[model samples]
Target: MKIVTGRMASALRLACMASTVVLLAGCTRYGQHGYARYRTNCGICHHGGEGMKGEIPPISGRVDRIAATTEGKQYLMHVLLNGLNGPLDIDGVHYNFSMPPFRTHLSDEEIASILSYLATRGDTQPVPVFSAADVAAERAHPMTTSMVAEERRRLDALHPLP
Candidate 1:
């Protein structure tokens, strides 16, 4: 009876582990979808895969570092909403490429997915899902002074003014 009980316990443990793995897998799938959305929308400038250079920063993994910060996250969202074509210092390298606004091209959910993918792929952090309300808010108000300050400070630190 004891041996049978032990076997049952082991089976239960295995089942629990399997379920947990499945759940984590689902979350990963969601992140991947978000990544795909980002690639479709922002990959032109950000470059999802290797090979491209000089024109824009490789946003796949490097962006997570910037997204980890509060201001960095907001800056990413703002950039998606209101694209910037100024000096960008990514991974200590200066990239002065123009990132045309994708506001009209992608909906807010799409933008959120891209940002979420960037944050997740770049770092171990789990970013909040972008919602329809988030899109509406950004479109209605856009970024304010404080958000801009945070972005500039972080970017300046990465790539000082020449």
Candidate 2:
């Protein structure tokens, strides 16, 4: 009876271990789906150390400054959907690159995943959840020079830069 009891206990332990392994694998698969999508699409330019002549920005840890601000986050979503041109300032350096709009190509969820992946890359922290509603709002009320100024003004009211 004792030998049979020991064998059953061992078998139960093995089954538990197997179950844990399968559960972990499923979680990894779920996370990797988004990662894979980013690698296939955005990684082409962002990961290529030296970006296209004047097309893509290095989207690795280089986006830290922009990701740290409310205005910047909104601007990023705007740029992702609407694209950008003219004198652009990111991380204090100016890039006169013009990004063709990807609004039609990428859904809001995909764009959010791409941004989340970019933010979590390297030592950077993950960005806040970017909802489809937020993207729609930005699209409905596009950012103009005045809007940028207004956002800055709001930030100033809170922090009051010296």
Candidate 3:
């Protein structure tokens, strides 16, 4: 997906940020803080975490399972910071592509917001809430894509993802 940046991007989310009061009062706090950003930034490729054609790795209903464990949660954070390249076998589908890193462009809170939005998408299941502090802690030490892939391997050995 082509990630847009600069003045144009800000204009898109300006409306959402401005309406935070209305959203928070009527809906979940998670959606208001992260909705617009997720739509423009993440929704482009992940499509509200539903993914596409098995190549994007849906986060909608499955991310809660991955974020349940501490290690799994870290893996998710690192994937955002370090990005993920190569192939992943999810269920019966083969997902192979490069998930670009947002470490530089996206802030700690932004990453947390998006991840938190994803984590809470599941209905009736309790999910870990990603905070800015959590993202900051993980950001202290960064990893490479290969390292992240290895972490995924380790996490997957214990918990298989969707």
Give the alpha-carbon lDDT of every model: 0.63, 0.58, 0.79
lDDT of 1: 0.63
Per-residue accuracy of model 2 over 24-142 as CA lDDT, tens digit each:
55332223554666777666665543354345556656444455667666866776776655544444555565555667787776766666555554353544445566666776765
Candidate 3 global TM-score: 0.79
Q: Which candidate leads in TM-score?
A: 3
Angstrom error at residue 51, model 3 = 1.1
TM-score list, all predictions = 0.63, 0.56, 0.79
Candidate 2 local Cα displacement, residue 62, angstroms = 3.1
- The list of candidate 1 runs beyond 4 A from truth reads 1-29, 49-51, 127-129, 143-162
Indicate the worst ten consecutive residues by lDDT in candidate 2. Answer: 25-34
Tally clashes: model 2: 0
lDDT tens string, model 3, 1-162?
245566667877897787876656533466666767688787889886778866788778666678888887888899888899989887688889789888998899888888887776775356578888999999999998989998898877776765
TM-score of 2: 0.56
